[model samples]
Target: MTYPEIKRFHSNMLESITSHASQSPVYQDLETISDIARLSQLPLTTSTQIQNSFDRLGVEKVLLAPIARFWYTSGSTGKPKNVYYGKRDLDDIATGFFQLLYLCGARPWNNAWVVTAAGGETLFGLVVEKYGLDGTISPLAGEMDMIKALRHASRLHKIDIIVTTTWLYLLINKIAKEPKEFERLVETEVKKKVKIPVFSTIVTKYLLRGINYTRLGGSLQNAKIGFSHAEALSPYLAKIREAYPNLEMHDVFGAAEQWVQAIQVSPEKDWLSFFLRYSIPEIAPPEEVIKGKEDRNYRVKGVPWYEWKKGLKGELILTRPNECLPLVRYPTGDLIEVMDPAFSFEVNLERGKMKITLPAIKALGRAADSVDFAGADESGNFLGFKVYSRQVSDALMTIRNVRWWELYHVKGSPGKFVFLIIPENNVSDETAFKDELLRSLVNMFQEFTAAAQARAFLVGGTAAMEDQKNYLELMITRPTAYELIDTEIKQRIKEGRSVGQLKPKRIFVVDSDEALSTLTRKKMEA
Candidate 1:
C-alpha cells in the first residue's frame, strides 16, 4: 500500500459509504457530499456523537450483517464509547495485530503470551496460534493474578514474547524489582476491597520464588521481545529498558474505536509507523487546537496525512471505512507529531503481504491534557507557552522512585501547577523524595523556557525573548490511596458497581478553582 494506493482506496471507501448514506441515520446528511477531497467539509465526528448515535447504524443493513463483538473505549476522560464490529471487522483487527507481531520479529517457532483485559477473546493470542506459534492469553479480570499467570505459563513453555498494556507491564517490572513492596501493595489493595486476585499461601510462596528466578535466570529473563499498548510508552521507555536490558520492546498505538493503528518499528526511533490498511490517517493542525478550550463538542478539521509534512504536529483523525459502525473523519483527540513523511517498512508474513510507505508519528498525549499559559516579559510584551502531559511525564520519569503522578492546572491560577504523586511504597524519606521532585521540575521548566525563547526569537524578535520566562508556582503533595483513585472509579465503587480495567489519568485541566481546591482538601483530609 503506497501513498497513492491508500488515497485511491480511501476515495473508493468514501464513494461506497456515501452511496448508502441515504439509508444511514447517522450519515444521512453526508449524502450531499460527493468529492472525497471534500472530507474536511464534514464536521469531525466525536466520541460523544458516537455514543449518542450508537444505535443508529451509519452503514446499511447488508454492512451490518452480524455483530461480531462489542468493544468500548477506555473512557479515561469521559463516558465509554461503544463500537459494534462485524466478523470481517474482527478478522481485520486480528490481521492488524498479526502485522504488528510480524514487524516485531515474530516467527512461527516463538512462544507468545498476551496479558489483557479481553481474556480468552484476545485476538493477539489467536493470531499467534494461527501463525503456528505457541500462544497464551492471560486475562487481568481477577480470575488469576497476572504475575502468577506469567510464572505458570513460563513453567509450561519458553515464553519468547510478552504482549500486554504499558501499565500492566510497568507493574510487572516494578514487582519484579521490589517483590516485598508489591506484596504490601497487594495486601493494601485487598484490604481496600479492590477486586484484585488474592494469592494463596502456597501460590504466594511460588510467586516469590518466581520473582527470585527472574532475578537469576527464568523465562522472563530469556524473553526476547515485548509489546505494550493501552497507554503512552514514550515516558516509560527508559524505565522499561533499564529493567529489561536484553529484551526488545515495541509500543503499539490503538483505540477501541479502531484496533492496532500503529506500531513502533525500531527501538531507536521515537515515532510509530501507521498501519494504512487498517484506517486512513489525517492530521488536524496543532496551532488550530493547541490553545482551544478543552471541550469535546469543539471540532477540529484535518488535512490528509499526505498533506502534512515532517515536523508538523496535530490531532490524529482516523476513518475506519470497513467497520459496521463506520467512523468517518473521526477526531481521535490524541495529539501527535509527524516524524517522517516517507517512512517505509517491509515484512513478509505467511498469511498476508505488507509493503507500504506512510508517515511516522509520535503521540504526545491527549490534546485536552494540556494547559496554555501567558505572562508579561519584563518589558511588558505578552509571552505565551503550553505544557502537555507528555512533557510532564518526561520530567517526572527522571525521578526513579515516583510510582504514580498527576498534574493539575486550575483555571484561576494561570501560572500555577499542582502535582499529586504516589511514591513507591519503599520510600523512607519524604524530604529526599520531595527535593528530587523539585529538582526535576526545575529542570523541566528551564527546558520549557529555553524552547519558548527559541520559538520567540524565530517568530518575533529580541523583545519577545527578553525576560520571557514566566513565574511558575509549583505545589507538590502526596495523596493517600483513597484520594489516588479516579473520581469515576470511586463513584462506581461507592455505588457497588464493577470498575473494570483501570488505567492511570495523569493530567487534568480543572475548569474552576473550587474544584481544584476540593481536590487538594480531600488529599489533606486523607
Candidate 2:
C-alpha cells in the first residue's frame, strides 16, 4: 500500500495495538500515524537514531529478561557508524532469511554456523540456532572471527549450514587469507567442504569474488547449496552452481522486525520452496516502516536499495502474521523484477514432500547492487527504460564502498543526469578512486545507459577530499573521469541548483586524474 493508505490503515492498527498492548516507544505515535497519512508526516529514525535510543535504554542486560544479547563489531573494529537493534527485532530476523535457505534446500535440522555481523549475541544468532531442528549453529563477527567460528564449528559432527556477511566471507574465500588454514578446514574430515551448506542473506560482487575463489579451490564440489539473503544475490551465484555441479544458490530476505517470513526469491522448478513453512509473500508498495516525509521521492536517495523497483520491478512487501509481532509490509530493501504481469499461488513440487511449501513469485537478482532502473517520463510515466538506471546502478555498486546512490541524467544535453553514489563506509583517496571508478563505471554503464553512462562517477565525502586540489576529483586511474565532472553539474541542475549555484561538483570539485593510475592500481588492485 502507498504510505497514505498505510497511514489510513494504521489508524485502525493504532487503535488495535494500543488497545491490545502498550510497549515500544511508537505506542504514542499511533495518533500521529493515524493523522498523518503521508510517509513524511511520521518521524523517521535511522540506525544512528536507533543507536541513540539504545544508549538512552542502556546496556545493563539485567532489566530485560529472557535476557537476550545483541552483537555489534563496533564497525570492523573500525566501523565509523554505530547501529542499534532491540532484542525482539533480532530474535525474529529469520523470517525471510530462513525462507531463502529453505528455497536453497537448507536442512532445517542441520547444524549450521552463522557468520555475520558482530551483534550475533542478539536475538538473530540465538533464534536461528534455536529454530534449527538438528541444525547446530554458531555466530561469528567479521572475517577472522567467522573463520575461527567455522573452524571450531567444524568439530561438530552434523553442522551443515553456514551464514556470513558479504565481506567476512569474501575476505576468507576470495583474498585467500590463510589459504592453507582455509583449505584445511574446507577439507576437514567431519564436515567436508562439499557437504557444507552456506546461507548468506545476500550476495553481491563480494560474494561473486568468493564464488570465484570457491571455483578455484575446487572446494565447491563439496558444497550442497549456497543461500543468499540480506541484500540482492548476484547472478554469480550461478557460477557456484556450475562449479559445484550438485549445488544450488538461493537468495533470501528478512530483518529484525518482520512479522512472518517472506520468500523474496523466485525458485526454479526443482528448487525447494518455503511459502508454506514460515511467511507469505506479496507485491505491493512496501509498508511504511520508516517514518519519513510524504512528498520526498518514494525511494530515498540512499539508505538501502532494494532489488525491487516500481513498474519493471516491484518490492517484496513482507507481511506479518497478526498473531506474531504484527510487522506488516515492512520495506525489506529487496527488489524483484515484475515480468509477465504478476504471479499467484502455486505448489512446491520439490519441497511439497518435505511439507515446507513456497508460494508463487517472480524474477529476482542475477547481479549485485543491481536495481531496476525504471525511469519516469517528463510527466513521471514509465520512461520505457525500466532497465536502464538499474544497469548503471549495478555497475556503480561494484565500487564495493558505497552505500547510497542516485542515478541522474540531464535532459536534451550531452550532460547525462549524473549518478551519485555515497560510500556506506568511510573511505580514503576517494578522488583518486573516483577516476579509477569512472573508467570502470563508464564501461559498465555503456552496456545499459549507452551515451549517458559516460558521465557518472563515484565521490567521497569532504574528509577524504582535503588533500585534493579540487573538491570533486576523479582518480586518474579510474574510468570516465571527464564524465564525472559533467554528471555532477547535471545532478545540480536536476536538484534545481542553477548555473548561478556553486555546488561541489560544479565550481568547487575538479576532476583530476594526474598520476591516478599508480594511485588507483595501488588502491584497487587485489
Give the candidate number with the greatest lDDT.
1
lDDT of 2 by residue, 1-526 (tens): 4334443554555444333222333222422232212322223333343344446765332122233333332221122332233455444455544544554567566655454433333444445555645433343322234445544444455435445433333433443334555454333422331343332212211222222332333342344555544433442343334434554455444444332244433444312122432332344332333322242224322211122232444444433323222322334444454432223333244537333322333334222223223334331211233333334444555565543444433332112234445553445777665776677664654444432222222234444323222212232222233334435433443433211121131111112233333323432332
What TM-score does structure 1 among the candidates reach? 0.78
Lowest lDDT 10-residue stretch of candidate 2: 501-510
Give candidate 1's error at residue 284 in angstroms.
Answer: 1.5
**Residue-wise C-alpha lDDT for candidate 1, range 329-437, written one tens digit per residue:** 7777788888898887665567786765767888777766666554443212224556767777877865777666778765542234668776645457777777788
TM-score of 2: 0.48
Residue pairs in clash, model 1: none
Query: Which 10 residues in a row give candidate 1 its minimum summed lDDT?
Result: 492-501
lDDT of 1: 0.64
Which ranges in model 2 have alpha carbons more than 4 Å from their true place?
A: 1-29, 32-104, 121-124, 127-138, 153-160, 165-220, 256-265, 269-342, 345-526
